[model samples]
Target: MTGTDQQPVSASLRIDGKDAELEQRLDDELTAFNAAATGAGAPEPLSVRVTDAEGALVGGLTAWVWGSCCAVDMLWVRADQRHAGWGGKLLRAAEEEGARRGCTEVIVSSFTFQAPDFYRGQGYRETGRTEGIPGGHEDVHFHKVLAG
Candidate 1:
């Protein structure tokens, strides 16, 4: 037996106030951890949005860059705004902006029902895939070489 008995959390849960504090602590610790490996700090997070003539947001891409890689966290478009080429335009704009920020590659993920093929058409190559998600869809990872 161990020195003490411990109780597990109720469910897929976290200790109440431990969440943000723990995350922040890990982030702080990772600075030295990452710097030792990469010799650079994390990339600054960036967001790019597309709006209409009336200034309503229709689509956007959010990404971050570090070590010459732009990791896209989100790419979304309003339903009514889809297929008018806005998605592609927004993605390209994000890539161009990343290039300006010195990114040499782009990485993103998509569900099987999402934009995996669309990203492929945009020159991203599939790098990984996993199945058995909650929605029975596959998660696909892609990477692209950005033009200098």
Candidate 2:
């Protein structure tokens, strides 16, 4: 709609929650735009999973490689499998895959009560932290350069 000044008016916004179709549409459009703008093409999903002998899920990592960077979206291990070094193994696998995809670095984050120390132990350095999260915890960010 055109406003009184004869300019296009912005569409009305809503707060409806959790729309998967809309989410996918937004992701698709943004990916197309990013590829067109940056010439980096599309992001490649990189997942590293660990399982038991029976193929039961134990731990995994989900990340994406875009341009020269790999962004770790989530890394989780089963409660029964925690501290067994599966997390590190999953991360290393992801990093190796990211490197194979032409990424030179990886970025990840965790909550204060989560695996900040784990990432540190994996040679990730804290880039920043956002305080005032619920329960007085902070969301910590980390980065690591992949070895050649």
Candidate 3:
């Protein structure tokens, strides 16, 4: 495998496809990093879902609590549900839970067309930016220091 100067791509991305073995291996590696940083075992996932009056799914927040930080992986509300305070409510819930778990900061990223401004409004300060990414938009990273 090392001597070949030219060879077909042996690895497949398998987008939207499940590779349980690979997934578990990656998780194990990441968890090791988490343990080293926090001595708190693996990163624990935190999620909150929103539903309509009929209990239909509408939106949710997904985060990983690791070390002293909560990494927000996804925050989404339905298009029709926008601008109704739901986004803020969900964000607060996630942040509160993180705080309760002794998390001292939150990290999240958003595309330019996404919630960069909203994250700023929620007290998240820009840590870095990647320009011209994923086409025309910039990707922004934010970090918030939680109040003790």
Candidate 4:
């Protein structure tokens, strides 16, 4: 080749129309994968049962079983029904259910504004604590071993 002559040069740039579609499909797949992973690892939602003493559903409790333990998610009695042992009754019911489900222990969590001492009075021991959540609030965790 002469100094003034030029050799052939080859170059290519591919733009597939399906590339965007493929990217979108991959994104959808990743999203589905992430959701499935999270759902499979997350604990089940608490199951709740309510009771109406008269015309009002004043007493209720929520719980969930995890492995050999049950979590008492919530226990509430009406304001007017306090000090009537309804709370203990509800807790006992939840414990019975937990035992029936092969749970050997029960755990309950309550905020500083709720029934921390009440649980202690019912044979629950404070196992954990977290302070300064959100609006300057503290949470207390409690646990109790079930009777085999």
Candidate 5:
């Protein structure tokens, strides 16, 4: 055979037809896994009470205590008394209660629509975040150290 008698080296590309189908299957599996994981757990219930200087209801905070940490589940101030330091006062009170209960840390979660900056101002640091809730608002998580 002559030196030039050889097969042509043609460049070709082969695309996998199952690429899109595999991606869809993986997405479906992930979605099912996430849904199952979320549905397997329930939040702990908490009770809270608040009173004004005159012993009337003004604001309150609620939390679930587990070991050395407490999860602040809710906090509310009277509408008419907002932006007047009542929220901070209530938070401080909650901190005191947590400390009394042997809690070394207090954690809180709120959406972008809530008082993230307020918590930051009160010495809480953002520890985590999530999306896709409350019309895509970010769920901001915060933590604070309690006095022993």
Candidate 6:
């Protein structure tokens, strides 16, 4: 093989404590590479937050928008505020924002012990599940088509 085809060998490896700078640099590099490879552009963050009259956080949803998809990373509501329907409102707002940003679908996952049925109530269909999480539970994935 030609010299140009030879892969460089790593001489050492070091495991270190958390470094924010290194984490940011790695994220930036990988994001650029993914954008270039998939033509999806860099993932943009989308969030929906709920607060009380005193501005105390009640619940929130966080997600990343890439190409035509919005992936919900977290959805949480204060225990006291949960059954009052804030979760649905937050999710609907996120979906609307995603549709406004040109996304056609949204995806989210929940642990079996968490809110798997909640997503279903919001019209998200179960797409898959990963078994054998602690305590014999599963990670359930869901998908929903945004209404334009």
Regions of model 5 farther than 4 Å from truth: 1-48, 52-56
lDDT of 1: 0.88
In the range 1-148, model 6's lDDT, one tens digit per residue, is 8867978797887789998998999999999999999999999999999999999999999999999999999999999988999999999999999998999999999999999999999999999999999999999999999987
lDDT of 4 by residue, 1-148 (tens): 7799987689877777668877979867875775586643223345545566565776888887765778887788889888888899888888888788778999989998888999999999999999987778789999999999
Better-scoring candidate (TM-score), 3 or 5: 3
Residues 30-116, candidate 2: write the lDDT tens digits.
Answer: 999999999999998889889999999999999999999999999999999999989999999999889988999999999999989
In order of appearance, the predictions have TM-scores of: 0.83, 0.90, 0.83, 0.65, 0.63, 0.90
Question: lDDT scores for all predictions?
Answer: 0.88, 0.94, 0.91, 0.80, 0.80, 0.95
Give the Cα error of residue 64 in candidate 1, in Å.
Answer: 0.2
Query: Comparing 2 and 4 by lDDT, which wins?
Result: 2
Q: Give the range where candidate 5 is weakest over 10 consecutive residues by summed lDDT.
A: 39-48
Candidate 6, superposed: residue stretches over 4 Å from native: 2-6
What ranges in model 2 sit over 4 Å off? 1-6
Which candidate comes out best when scored by lDDT?
6
Instruction: Indicate whether candidate 3 or candidate 6 has the larger lDDT.
Output: 6
37-138 per-residue lDDT for model 1 (tens digits): 998676678888999899999999898888788999999999998988988998898899889988899999999998898999999999999998777899
lDDT per residue, candidate 5, 1-148, as tens digits? Answer: 8988998799887777668877979867875775577652223335466676799888888786655677888898888888988788878877777677667998999898989999999999999999888787999999998866
Weakest lDDT window of 10 consecutive positions for candidate 4? 39-48
Q: What C-alpha lDDT does candidate 2 achieve relative to the native structure?
A: 0.94
In every candidate, how many clashes are there?
Answer: 0, 0, 0, 0, 0, 0
Model 5 Cα displacement at 83 (Å)?
1.0
Colliding pairs, model 3? none
Could you tell me which residue pairs clash in candidate 1? none
